[model samples]
Target: MKITALETLRTDEFANVLWVRVHTDAGVIGLGETFYGAGAVEAHIHDTLAMRLLGRNPLHIEAIHREMLNLPMAQSSTGVEHRAASAIDIALWDVFGKICGQPVHQMLGGLCRDKQRIYNTCAGYRYVRSNNIKPVSNWNLEGNEGPYEDLVGFMTRADGVAESLLESGISAMKIWPFDPAAQENQGLYISAEQMKKAIEPFEKIRKAVGDRMEIMVEFHSLWNLPAAMQIARALEPYKPTWYEDPIRMNSPQALAEYAASTNVWVCASETLGTRYAYKEYLDRGAAHVVMADLCWTGGLTEGRKIAAMAETYHRPFAPHDCIGPVGFIAAIHASFSQPNTLIQESVRAFYTGWYNELVTTMPVIKDGYVYPMEGPGLGVELLPAVFERTDLTVRRSSL
Candidate 1:
């Protein structure tokens, strides 16, 4: 069957727009999630990529992918081009999977493990409250006022939340001190006293949890190298499972320096896209852990390739999940099919009722591990009405 139509659907949820709903003529369609802040990708999807996709065989994913890359659609490669390529790639895979009557993971080489382990990120919301700081722009999930009440409000609620996540059988959680108040301090050289103060919440949690959970410190690329090193040194005693994006992701050499200096595992690459972008980091031994985002790092097609590349370096891969259900499921397919995958990032924000409107099947989280659907393709369907609640528009055009 040939491609019939390509669509770009935008949603108002998270104040974000994800490209969705690729259509083909053989009574099959595929869905994909484009990441946040890549509207140029959506424009390319309409103005450039659509021309190459129309009338092409959906099953020829690699050839279509190669053509898209070489098609001179853009003067440079950035998240926008990658996001456009990723959405189309994911849709093609979904179509191919439907045609083959198998899940995407099976098509990738079958399951490495029946279930994937997930680390919670929603737990990070409390760090803002406990520190008595106002939430910053983009830090609050809802984009509203103060996220939590106060330190006591945060502490009391945080315990119950952790207990609930633990009870749900989640083994690991990621907490970020990503308050807006903290953003101004980011990338600035912080004093040792400030670094110590920044780490107090993690120290307290480690003492309370006592090794029962893995805490991943996310700086959001806020600290300079020296400050990051100092903070890493201070938190070394607590034994965080990983330190995420301590320094900026702009240079492999900078990341390498931090990795070389810290005993804590350095994780990077959520901002990175495609194999070419990941190569420098791998060659330089820049990171101990590679965190690839399915939505941001070229979807499952490129994410799996990146995972393979990371495996050659003997590093663990944790597919990043920070968006909607489509991103989560696509990441799961990649993670399930890769043996070297360390953990998958997730949050209650998506899995709970809030995300239910976006898709039919909730990610199966049992006892800290996620299970890919035995169903076909991505195996999740979004109800048509859900889009109605979202102030999103879908338009498809061909060059």
Candidate 2:
């Protein structure tokens, strides 16, 4: 079916999320979402991408994906251009799945497995709720919303948080206690005191759950290479499952050095855009586990390619989903479709909290494993309340 209109929606409440709806001539609409910098992504889709997308065949996903990347600015980075293109690409796939009367995972190549293991990203209810994307400011750690205020739990009572996750059958949890030190020192160096304090959570987790809970230490690309290596050396004793984005993703050689220095797997990044950038990391043996945020890394189209490339290097793919509901669903589809998908990244805070408020359906996440989603397309839709919300702002570009 021909793409008739491209509609984008954003709400003042969810400032960092932008939702795109691809309206087709056959009256089937496909939904896609991208997180962070909603304003810029929205502007790119309507002001720039609308010209390339309108009246085109929505099912010709590869052609449209290539046309979307034709701009010089859209090359190999998870910037605004990639984010906008990613949303549209996901929407196009959604259209294809709906037209074929199959789920997006089936459209990608069907399920490799019936379920995938998941790791809980320990973020609080209101984490990254504001426009500020920085560490301390973006945390939104003001109030105790409910039982799963995990960001606070991990910081103050990590032992308790680990026990809680274990109780829920979640064997893996990702935490970033070193971010404060990175923010304070501008990622240059960590003092002895800072190092001691940052190591507390790991100590607590080990004391509480021992090896039962797999710990993924997230550095959030905040530290310099030397400092990152220092931190990695210190945490080696704890036997963390992985070190995620310990340093910036720009230098493959530097990252390879960091990886060579440590025994723990180095999960490269969700910041990278496409397989072209991932190839650099794989070629250099920098990243042991490949991570991509489907929403920003060109959606499922590029996401599957990245997964395959990682597979070639004997690496495992883990899809990132600390974003919006639609993007999370898309990641699940990618996770199940790829044969070498190691695990899925999820936030207990987001999934159990605000995610349900915006989406009509979500994957059945039970006992730390996410079961395959049912129905056509991404198997989820924006809730009716989201459309009717008073804070919502909708924009459209029609043929």
Compared with the true structure, all predictions reach lDDT values of: 0.72, 0.93
- Model 2, residue pairs in steric clash: none
lDDT of 1 by residue, 1-399 (tens): 788888777655444547566788898988888766645667888787887788888888888877776765432243677777777888888887888899989988999987888888863332222222233444434332233222232233444445556677875767665333256665566655556556666656665666786777777777678777777787889788999988768888988888898788988868776778778888888888989887766667778888998999999999887666787888889889999999988866546644666678886787888888877888877777766764677687531
Per-residue CA lDDT of model 2 for 365-391, tens digit only, reads 899999988889988899999989999
Error of 1 at 301 (Å): 1.4
lDDT, model 2: 0.93
lDDT of 2 at 48: 93
In candidate 1, which residue ranges exceed 4 Å CA deviation?
Answer: 71-78, 123-135, 141-161, 178-182
Candidate 1 TM-score, true structure as reference: 0.89
Evaluate model 1: give its lDDT.
Answer: 0.72
Error of 1 at 117 (Å): 1.3
The clash count for each model shown is 5, 0
